[model samples]
Target chain A: MVHAEASTFAEGLSKKQVYEQVLGQAQALFDGQRNWVCNLANASSLLYHAYHSLPSPSNAVNWAGFYVLDPKNPKQLILGPFHGQVACQTIAIGRGVCGTAVEKKTTQLVEDVERFPGHIACDGASKSEVVVPIFQDGRVVAIIDVDCAELSGFTVEDQVALEHVAELIAKSCDF
Target chain B: MVHAEASTFAEGLSKKQVYEQVLGQAQALFDGQRNWVCNLANASSLLYHAYHSLPSPSNAVNWAGFYVLDPKNPKQLILGPFHGQVACQTIAIGRGVCGTAVEKKTTQLVEDVERFPGHIACDGASKSEVVVPIFQDGRVVAIIDVDCAELSGFTVEDQVALEHVAELIAKSCDF
Candidate 1:
């Protein structure tokens, strides 16, 4: 799975440049790929590479990553490739909004950090957050996420983007 | 499933503005509720209201949607709910780049229409396109789609928006 695909992603790209690259690549890949999971993985890897190392590039998000569903266990979405200081490899289906998304079978966009039940503090600094569900057979299977150090960092533009992507998943995912 | 949830939304918002309102509602519901399927379903309904009968709005995308994975079938992205039409219900995973995205598990930025294989002509005039994947368990389960009637209709900003939602699905999915 570790291919030399992202090599041209600019080892020399600055943090700001990296973020711009991530953003650019995000648009490019999405327009080019039109597939949600692949784009999700790509976006997660790009952001992870930029942010996972903390004191990361200026543009990298503080904490960002994805937890995918196991084909063997559709009940939970295990943390897959991401960008941030570290990763949360395990999350149950009904535990938090992220997990509850599966149980609830819907996208959960949390604007306030303090109110969520079972919220994991992987990054205590993350204030506002958003989670969109990936569905199959009218069922919740996985979730996509973005966390920011700033409270209410998630925006209208951001919601539209995420929701649009979620919309795509709902349509094309026949797996 | 068809509750009068967005009746208010329908009253105040223009057809084009409906997408934005739905996105806003979707974001709030994400943070506040656990009805994952309902959340997405509602979002789809808003989009359907916004552009379904309109003449593909000007200055913005006319319609947008996604596909989901079906446990029983891995070869196609079963169209779930969308903002435009219902005919795009079943698209083979390998027929078009959208399908190939499932095949490659990679994002595709297509600037031209005739280039992709099995490209379902949701909007035959659509020139440029973007496909982002929704993943669960390191495997692609769906795709996010944004189509414009104009060729090369997408930009970096659009990509950012689409990917954000895509990530939301990846993170908020039941997984």
Candidate 2:
């Protein structure tokens, strides 16, 4: 939870302003918290709340969470902490957007899940998605996945800010 | 997640209409899902999305989720599926608002958390809260907890509709 004392984005704030506040809250919420689960839990919560407070297009966010690489199967991803509906439990490294992010070691910002070939429909309400791979020791460790209810719900600003959050989580947690 | 094909609330609908729609969605979302975890996951998602579409005061909601009775410790309530920040992991029965609801076996609708004595500060940002006990076999199995960012955020109508939701969840899930 973002501390009650943490700064809040004023109504009608720009995306950059919101992400900036989110980054501050993310650092404050995650710093020194070494448990990956706790870190992801709070980080996802911070993003979910921050964007939900923003304008119409941004506030349509329906899902925000993570998918961590399975230790038993390095090439597969398993469900992690999340803030929305029951999700698909597992995805192969190259099967879905999350897996594709892990396989490519890059961010996947899908403007429309329906248009993205081989898209995995975990929550049927999600229309767009952004998945950012978290890295540790020069390899992908997990991916931060955010889904919005509107098509093209995410933008470049969200991608950049979330990538920063993923980096922070990768470094702070003892994954 | 509410299925993309699920009927949606039309623009500018009345509060009563919205809740009725929400109730219908809740039933449809939970109908065939028997797993307790999966049921709570989708139930909360349904509420979160249903309210997020409402107007200002109604849209002030920040947290929606559950606290189930821990089998090993019937005197405590353990956090279950939730949307919002990381929450308080446990609340002793007869203690906090959640506990008070369990002890009293009634719905709790607090207009302001600040005025509620011994209110547990799970999320400092939460100003108002509502908790409804889910009963099974004549005992409380869980409580549906909703928190809002605005003081006096919940209403009698909300209490009624959410209580209905709790009843549905209690009946549908295999606790």
Candidate 3:
């Protein structure tokens, strides 16, 4: 991290640097703020601003937001706070990219959404995608979904870092 | 156009058809709802859903949202309701793609964000972008910013149609 301004990151930060900055921001945003909606809103905002500033391919993240499992329907996920265009309102547990993350209880880094069978096209411009499940009390509560325009846009590092963010949210927020 | 289910459009609707459908939905969503935040929120959602369900290539829209002129700071554009990841909250006029649109008070369609000088990267995945200014009494009030992952994602028809939507919004909403 060639230190630039503290508010705006120096251009050309490595992906690792960007993720580190994002994780730190996430911690600061969620600190002592157990309000789920506010935390998710700012977290998504922090991730967007962080990834938006990175260079080329690594910075190609188009969408980042959360989808919480509907308390009314254990088998369904509903739209929560997000930073992108409007998205699908409900997704079944076993359906689409977000649902699959919940069904599998793991991070999914999809290189091509068109190739993902049953993939929900919330933003057709989204070519590749990733979804990380957030768990609390040993059950899935919400998932973070990020989409990109290029195929194979997300790497394993992104999965790991975002999963770490998810873990943070799982521990920090009140659901 | 081939007739498909009413809920789902036929695969190859001309640009005209897509815009018409989008404009209709925009009208329905904004009807009698004058609140700016709610109106912007639903408008972005309507556009995202309309475009996301389209066929490939045309469906490649990545970001759809608004940047309203700040009431306190006349020279700034503040992030408004949107459907994608978090975004840069404040943009100075003439600084970035969104700001440039406001500065010029005209529609801007860029094939590549990387090439656009002083372009602020809100989402690294956005390769192509279009911004349309919303005018009230011959002054810019807000602008609609749409981004795509693919180069040249938007078309002239999108400009015309989205401009129409902006007109409707300017007329319908109390800003």
Candidate 4:
């Protein structure tokens, strides 16, 4: 495995590297990695898959995943994999980051984390965040999420990267 | 366009019927036919889509969209879809129907609702449910849910139907 400086991942990060890293991590974990559940839980599978497939590293801030617990209930959004600090659990359908994400049914790549309201502090240090809803049979079952320490963690490239992740999620669900 | 009694759907209800019904309903709300999202939210989507395409449904389930929500956060997965009647929005990573589903990372189709423990009561009326996870890339991002107001709302056909839906979701995601 290749070790990259956080700084190297910070500036001019290529999407390929991001995706490769995530794939590598997933492959390693899948190759009997320890406490697989620790990383696999909370949409980490989607996160690892999406993160590695991205084409631009600069867009890492926007990488994330959101899932649902009960779509018929409209009460919560499931937490998935992320690139930055974030809550590791459910979000109400009409409440904070998860709630707003559900309410809008659209992906939000927050540029400034401080300005956002009701931001869950899984990693209190995290600033920017991105969220995307997971739709089931026309209804949103969950969402894709991402968090970043940088204010401008998300960008068009990040959005594009997630779109690919979303597509990957959309395709690989054959259980 | 077609409103068949839920019971009628039980008797060889063609997957095409499910797809048509799902898309028809989605079109009523959204602007277009993004079959992948609308279909995969529930395992029925796969069954229905396959029915539409192959005129035959496969036996599969999609699980990934939903998660057990953190009560303190009250945002994400509290339980899995196709669950029994209980307050399941706050299930742990490996408890109850939701947790069991995540632990296995596969669809759990209960034949009898009364037999299952940790059943949530979003609708006590439902006797049977099918929960399928939706995947983006290789990770679970959402789940396809199917519930029968009666016992055994799902079948092998239903399983295939929902898996088709999961495929659509996987295709639509950003990964």
lDDT of 2 by residue, A1-175 (tens): 3344353457877888888887877777665446565556566666777778888778999778888886657878866667765566468999878888998899999999998878988768889999999999989988999999999998898889888888888878766
Q: What DockQ does each candidate score versus the true complex, computed on alpha carbons? A: 0.02, 0.17, 0.08, 0.02
Docking class of 4: incorrect
Q: Judged by lDDT, which candidate is best?
A: 2
User: Taking the tens digit of each residue's C-alpha lDDT, what string does model 4 give over A1-175?
Assistant: 1111111223344665665445444344333222211223323433533443444333344334345454334475543333222233345676656678778877777877667787655555556777665554655655666666567766776666565555444433421
lDDT of each: 0.55, 0.78, 0.75, 0.46
Clashing pairs for model 2 are none
lDDT of 1 by residue, A1-175 (tens): 1122341354554444544555555555455344444455445555544443334222334545456675556665665433333334456788766777677766666776778988877556667677777666766655767777666655564555565555554554333
Model 2 residue runs over 4 Å out of place are A5-41, A51-62, A66-95, A99-115, A120-128, A132-143, A148-175, B1-8, B12-16, B35-37, B52-57, B69-78, B83-92, B121-127, B136-139, B149-156
lDDT of 1 by residue, B110-142 (tens): 777677766767555567777778777888867
Q: Highest DockQ: which candidate?
A: 2
lDDT of 4 by residue, B90-157 (tens): 44545545556655778778766678887654445546767766666565555554455556556776
Error of 2 at A14 (Å): 10
Which parts of model 1 have CA positions greater than 4 angstroms off? A1-175, B1-25, B32-36, B45-60
Model 3 agreement with the true structure over B119-168: per-residue lDDT tens digits: 88766777898899999899999999888879988878788888998998
Which is superior by lDDT, 2 or 4?
2
Model 3 backbone overlap count: 10
Q: List ranges where model 3 is wrong by over 4 Å.
A: A1-7, B1-175
Worst 10 residues of 1 chain B by lDDT: B1-10
lDDT of 3 by residue, A3-63 (tens): 1122255688888888888788667656655656546755766676677787766567767
What CA root-mean-square deviation does each model show from the true structure?
Answer: 19.4, 5.4, 9.6, 18.8
Q: Once model 3 is optimally superposed onto the true structure by TM-score, how far is the C-alpha of residue B112 displaced, in angstroms?
A: 34
